[model samples]
Target: MTRSYDEWKAAAAAMEFDGRPVIGGVRVAARSGETIAKTNPATGEVVSQIHACGQEDVDAAVAAARAAYEAGEWSRAGAGFRRERLLAFAGLIEEHADELALFDSLDMGKPVREAAAIDAPGSAALYRFYGEAIEKAEDLIPVTPPGSTALVTREALGVVAVIVAWNYPLEIATWKLAPALAAGNSVVVKPPVEASHSTLLLAELAIRAGIPAGVLNVVTGRGSAVGRSLALHEDVDMLAFTGSTEVAKQLQQYAGQSNMKRLALEAGGKSSNLIFADCDDLRLAAQKAAFGSFYNQGEVCSANSRIFVERSVYPEFLELYAEAARAYAPGDPLDPETGIGALVSEAHADTVWATIERARRDGTIAAGGTRPEINGSRAFIEPTIVTDVPADHEVHTREIFGPVAVVAPFDSEDEAVARANETPYGLAASLWTGSLARAHRVSQRLVAGTVSVNTVDALGFTTPFGGFKQSGFGRDLSVHALENYTDYKTTWMQWG
Candidate 1:
């Protein structure tokens, strides 16, 4: 059953941690005893206090991960044992799905239903999928002439530092941790300070599921401190991050300056949604595009923020799209029925409003460019759609990271393809066309990592997800993600 906003808020306030951060099977406070407040975006209230991790805390977390990796506690464990433990973890997540969903909603301002149905379920599926993959993964195979042989093996990269973004905190963490753990790497998770409660709670759940201490560690602090320290830590063997493109660049620089650790980043996107003249279902296309760009208050990195419509259907498409946008109601995240929740915080919401105002000063506002009213003193922006934005406008090129989309008109297939690939980011794109040949051609020309031919933002667990160019390199889900956390070793031997 879904709880009311007041009930959810009350439950969150009543929830409490044991007054210490979980590290190496022990609950201990930071030596400095500082704490960071976790705020509820829906109400602008402090939901909980997380450890204010510093350089020393980061060092301790890294040491714990290093020790676990060096001892072969996670990496050297047999595939069957790892699989069993991971499956158990997945089950635990499912068992506590309600609490986890509530925590995520309260902490991150994502809709409760989505947190329960999509984010949490997707995370659990990742663990279960990786667990199964580990069981079937093959060991070293010999290849050579009859007299000589070579062995190819995969080894875990020790001490992975997983830095997750505030949006989809728990889901992103699982995307990095599940595969890394399954592939035998210890992980030190640095969750965004804005939404660290769910991640910290997940770490506790890991302990309950029998995961060894130090195999997983949670450090909460601002990116400049804890996050920067982890990126530059010498003991960290790999860095898996999902955030903005600018931060990813900084992380790359830090890694280069440090131990040159392996870097896997899934960064920002100015994803496009194309509606061809031949599309038979204009309403469906409009609905999908609306949700793709506006869902999660448009906080998704892979949001379809750019919409290109064929000139023939442009007029009709705009009408339908506007209706769909109006249907999305922005309200408190704790309201399970709310379609659109608050932005992550007041500062973020102000930035989004400022971006809209800037866009208006530079161009014309086609649709919503205002804030919505809510009972709580938190950040909440309406679903906005802008037209007449030039191709070079900041709104078109930059990642607004809000429920704001820009619509542009295209004369032909070639023009649509060109406009779609014009942005600096190439993370994901969607095409709406009835012709199979056009779909194939346009998808090939569009320079994104994931393309949905008839849909928008339809990413699956088995498929690899990442981006090209400035969107950052390295895949995030499936076997590809596992390979990113491990290094391949080849051995050649000759006998008399």
Candidate 2:
């Protein structure tokens, strides 16, 4: 099921965005008249060009969102009414799965199958789950003592600025958008300039799904321009972002300088995958670990990049893991058979290569340390696994954010826990062990927001996902996300 270049091109051309990007039911371009060319990272080919948003565009979008929120037609409407609209939106996303998947593949270099199966389906499920969850949300618990009355209600926090990263643009955008909109907040989305096409299209779908005008706005531009404006805009009530820790810091400063908007940042991670010798399923663990790190060209923030194997089975585990890594070769993203694809951009691929080089200079290369050949001039990199990397190596500590895994041997469970928690990040970790007691002990010790026992990336829409420490705070994609976009109002009244 390998799709040819012509097929991919045809698909991309046929994919429509329901006219132009929507803002308050109006089709509008950038007021500045500037534009950015959307290039396919896999082939360095220009897919399309979008009007580059400037400060004026940001203001307009925010004004639209603010007006929507103030009008209370969407946010202040009955929860049941909001629920119906969100359900319709989810249905629309499911109906347009092919177009959304194709656009994501072309814009982000992810395999079409993966995008269609995992990313797009996951997004639809998120909206559906949150939509249903919000309907059941009510003030059931009273805050008054004895018979005294105090009502606890959840109020929308007005306009939200959701700034998503380029790695998994549509997926992460839906992660923020689903819950925010379900909680009844008008959204001003600032998608990464590198991959804004699909996001803009999603905004169109929202409009078609009967989302009130101005409830969801899409602004496309560089982070310095539109992103900064959204974060600093006084009308913006909250900011939900997913990207690097450095950028998250800058966003925090922006939020502070502005109106102290609520900030939900899901940032960088240097996660570890621990494989104990007692695990009966070394083969399964090896496969999951390899895919967990190398999937999405290692663009995942919660990738299990640092692997710690028990000394007893270290050699055999490395062999199996390397074999699994080789199974995921770089291929054309449009091909359904392709398990792994390009690295988003040539510049990003170069950065990944440089990081691998740095690791090799400081540590022993285990398996892949070279680039793979591609049919087109795309940003493709071979999946790599390195061993004998010191704990202090930058590759082990920092977020390489590419298809590279650094394996290190550990003798005991305590050592594995220590190694896992050595980095500034506490995003996610994975443990593979057969013993229940050992699983409980290790999971408790791991200083990460999400820990997978005998699993890799089993992320679901119902679970609260976020990070701790420098990985950034706040949650997304669940009831926790609903709370992030809402403010609690406690009303106290004295009986006359």
Candidate 3:
């Protein structure tokens, strides 16, 4: 059953936070007296505060993670022990699901309903999935050419540093956090400073689940200070980050400059949702197109921002797309009926609206291209759709992280495929058509890491998720994701 709007509001009202950085399994403050101000975007009010950690804080977190990894309590624990504790963690998260959802909604401006319905439950599911995976994982013995036998074994990668984006705070963090821990790696999670509350709350739940101190740590602060320090720290054996393409590259450099640490990065996307005249369900496609572009206010890295319609059905689909966009008027994120919410920050909202303004000049503002009035202020943006924009426009090329969608028409499948890969991003793409062969053929040619047929932004924790080209590399889900956090070693022995 879907959660109602009033229940979402009640959850927000019941939300509580003890704002402090959880370092080495303890709630503490920054040594430098810095603090991360949590301003609620829905109302422009400072609702909470977290320790604004810097280099010293990062060092402590890393040291703690390293100590725990070396202690072998978590890293070397038996699969049964890990499985029991992880399932408990998942159960605890579910028990406090509303609290986690509330924290995420307040911190990142995500809709309360989405936080409760999607992010919170999704995080718990990932933990259970990986917990089960770890328990069933098997080592292999290779057949030898002679009397000797070779064995391959998977081992933990020691201390890992996980950096999650603000858009889907708890959910994305769990993508890394669950796998790292399941693979027997102690982890320090570096959540975006503005949205640290959910992670801080998660740490407390972890402790309650009987996860020992130092096994999982949270260091909250500005990315420039704490994030960079963790990325460059030699004590951190591996880094798993989910954010922008630019930041992922910088972390790659940081790894090389430090201990040449392992880095798994899931970055940005300007995914395309190609709709053909022969599509079986244009209505579903259009609705998903709007959802792919406007869900979470289009803060999703793999948003289907570019909608390319077959020219024969372009006008009809555009109207349908516009109609779908109109349904997502921004409201108090706490409002359950609200389809869109306040963006993560005022500056980000400015950038989003600024791009809409640019689209106003460069393209036809098909549906919405202005900010919404809420309490006589402009904290929220109306979901926007732009048509007739030139292919080379920045709004078409760059990622405008907002509730904005750009529509264009393509004459042929070849043109659609070519235009889809025009942007530097290659994270995810979707094709809507009836012909199974065309779907497979186009999917083969598309450069994105994941392609969906008759769907937009089809992502689940059961499948490996990542990007290609500038969108960064590494799979973040499924059994394959465990590879990102583990190392395989081969042993050869002579039994004869």
Candidates' C-alpha lDDT:
0.86, 0.86, 0.87
**Cα RMSD for predicted model 2:** 1.9
Report residue 319 deviation for candidate 1 (angstroms).
0.6
What's the TM-score of every candidate structure?
A: 0.97, 0.96, 0.97
The ten-residue window of minimal lDDT in model 1 covers 16-25
Q: Can you write out model 2's per-residue Cα lDDT over 374-413, one digit (the tens) per residue?
A: 7565488888887776678888888988999999899888
TM-score of candidate 2 relative to the true fold:
0.96
After superposition, which runs of candidate 1 have C-alpha atoms over 4 Å from their true positions?
1-10, 17-20, 140-142
Better of 2 and 3 by TM-score: 3
Candidate 1 structure lDDT: 0.86
Task: Return model 1's CA RMSD, one decimal.
Answer: 1.6
In angstroms, how far off is 356's CA in candidate 3?
A: 0.8
User: Considering summed lDDT, which 10 consecutive residues are worst modelled in model 2?
Assistant: 13-22
What stretches of model 2 exceed 4 Å from their correct place? 1-9, 16-21, 140-148
Runs with alpha carbons beyond 4 Å of true place in candidate 3: 1-14, 145-147
- The local distance difference test score of model 2 is 0.86
Clashes of each: 0, 1, 0
Candidate 1 residue lDDT tens string, 387-433? 88778998888999998999989998888999999988999999999
Better of 1 and 3 by lDDT: 3
